[model samples]
Target: MKNSRFSEAQIMSILKQAEGGAPVSELCREHGMSSASFYKWRAKYGGMDASLISEMKDLAE
Candidate 1:
């Protein structure tokens, strides 16, 4: 699979920014990602912490 420019940790942090009351448009603009991409990430990674992401990676490996 192709890897994204931002890592899972980075994605989580970006999502956190949105949860912290940052506007989705500004977050996307700052991160150079589209609003659609942000929504996709939120759908996939929402409510998940970095440790859970690492665990999922370990399982995939």
Candidate 2:
């Protein structure tokens, strides 16, 4: 598996910001991440919390 620049928790928090009505473009800009990466993370980790992400990672491993 490839290592991500941002941790799962950070990804989840960024997703939460999007969920809470933050604009994706602005979030991406502020976070210095590309829109592609943000959407990719959202697609994979959209509704997942940190613990759930850890569980999924464990299962994948």
Candidate 3:
């Protein structure tokens, strides 16, 4: 699998920003990522935290 440019913590921060009423378009522009990427991350990581992501990665290994 390809590695992501943003770390899990960064992804979580971005998602939290979106949930905090930040406009998706503005976030995408500010983050230099496309809306699709944001949505994909949301689908995969929504409701998950950094510790959970690390645990998942550890389990995957």
- The lDDT, on a scale of 0 to 1, for candidate 3 is 0.95
Better of 1 and 2 by TM-score: 1
The C-alpha lDDT values of all candidates are 0.93, 0.91, 0.95
lDDT of 1 by residue, 9-34 (tens): 89999999999999999999899999
lDDT of candidate 2 at residue 39, scale 0 to 100: 90
State every prediction's TM-score relative to the real structure.
0.92, 0.91, 0.92
Candidate 2 stretches greater than 4 Å from native: none
For model 3, residues 8-46, the per-residue Cα lDDT tens digits are: 889999999999999999999999999999999999999
Error of 2 at 37 (Å): 0.5
What would the per-residue lDDT of candidate 2 be over residues 1-61, giving only the tens digit for each residue? Answer: 6878998878988999999999999999999999999999989998888788889989988
User: Which candidate number would show the highest lDDT if scored against the true structure?
Assistant: 3
